[model samples]
Target: MELRWNPILETWVMVSAQRQRRPFMPKESCPFCPGSGKVPDQYDVYLYPNDFPHLMKDPPEPSIQDDDLLRVERAFGSCDVVLYSPDHTASITQLSREHLARLFELWRDHYRAMRERADVKYVLIFENKGDIIGVTIPHPHGQIYSYPYIPARPAKELDSARRYWESHGGACLFCAVLQKELAFEKRLIWTNEHFVAFLPSYADYPNEAHIYPRRHCGSLLDMSKAEAEDFMDGLQRQVRIYDSLFGFELPFMMGFHQEPVDGAEYPYFHFHVEFYPLHRSRDKIKYNAGSETSGGAFTNPSSPEENAEELRKINAEL
Candidate 1:
């Protein structure tokens, strides 16, 4: 795979033709199952190299020519799969508090380790749940991708946050959003001492939620032990609420938003987790068609207030 620069969009596009051959929903033994021979038995949280990785630590030379407009580079990065539980059918919502705390610690450790690499510029921690989210494996796991450069979305967020900081006298943009949400309490789902989960007023998807730390922190490494516990508490509660909403497992994409490891200070950037659930109702799924895919616009079917009220009514027993 090669990283081709798109001059028009100012982003790097990963061209990995080999990924099409990766395994889909296999009917035989699961690769993530304990003692399946692919993975070891008796492990609380497991981290292993991805069987099909998109990037590498030392990648091949660029395949194409480099010019003023078209530039190509090797995809130098690392990808790791994090198994959340040993059980084959376990879900994040079902994991114990202690287990989830351990998982968070693993996440922090991996992030710090990846950031330590001189070539690594950014680390992304995210999970895609359910078949609708195009997850081939049924195991409860997440993936970490350490990139040589910052991805487009996060770069855009950082730029915005930087501009906000400059204009607002070094105030964090996310912390401001969290404070505003707390004052309104209309879109809030749950809040503890350290963190708060709320359906943002500008949510792009139905029932979309953003969890933010009350204090400003650039990355997971900055979170204290107490803050980590509260963060896990908020995350677990949010997942449970999603499952309880439609009386089934909800398909969603959850990702952590944090500072890049490019060795730059980002006091204006606050760490958070964003959840985008695809389901609009019990049997309906929201598809990102024309506007969302081509026009770069999101057309949310429901209002944030209505969605928050629906989620607020469901008190998921944790």
Candidate 2:
């Protein structure tokens, strides 16, 4: 099995075809279980360096200098897992405000710790929820990954934002988008003094939502205590609304994008949260068939506007 870098596509393609045939179990013994060898049962939150890392801080072995046409560079980075709660049944959205705040505290701490490493430039925190998303463990947890190089999606966004900032004499692209959504209000779900959740006009999924700090903060790592508290409050409320919309505990992939932890500052970058759910309705699932995989196009069952309206109604009733 090998991983190849596709320079034209600007992505890493895992060349292991057998990986698609790997066995998956919904009830497998979780390696992250407390008192299961690595950690004790009394821990409410656990953070450990991953045994299988995509990148390591240590220098890599000599590269195989094949033909110049087929060059391969080592992708060095680290991956770690964060146990969100002691109770495996609880999800991030199900966490109490206090527990959620503690989680946020750890997030901030991890960001600082990873960024201090000279090899790490970008740090990403995200979660894949439910077995449908290929998450084997039922535990309420997420993963933290630190890369020596900026990731493709974030690098592209940063470039675009930097260009926009230069053109506008220092302006945030996301802040402008947030202003537009606030004025429109049709796509707005909820907001407080510090944060807002809204469905973007150019949403890629039926129920896609973006949560952002109202202030033009660079990243979650830089958020003040008050701002962090308000952000968590809005986050929990949004999750409840999502669950109510489907009349069940909703499943979604949530990720936070922040400025890279490297010493350089990104004045144009604004911290934000993105949630993309696979389900379009109670029974309908959004499957990314060949079109999405091969052509980079999407076909959503419901319009973003309609979905926003439905979400708004549910949020209000809740």
Q: C-alpha displacement of 312 in model 1, angstroms?
A: 1.2
Over 4 Å off in model 2, which ranges? 1-3, 12-28, 59-67
TM-score of each: 0.97, 0.90
Query: In order, what lDDT does every prediction score?
Result: 0.89, 0.80
Give the winner by TM-score. Answer: 1
Q: Which ten residues in a row have the lowest lDDT in candidate 1?
A: 309-318
Model 1 regions lying over 4 Å from their true place: 316-318
What is the clash count of model 1?
0
Best by lDDT: 1
Per-residue CA lDDT of model 1 for 23-61, tens digit only, reads 885756688888888788788899989887878987788
Q: Per-residue error at 89 for model 1, in Å? A: 0.4
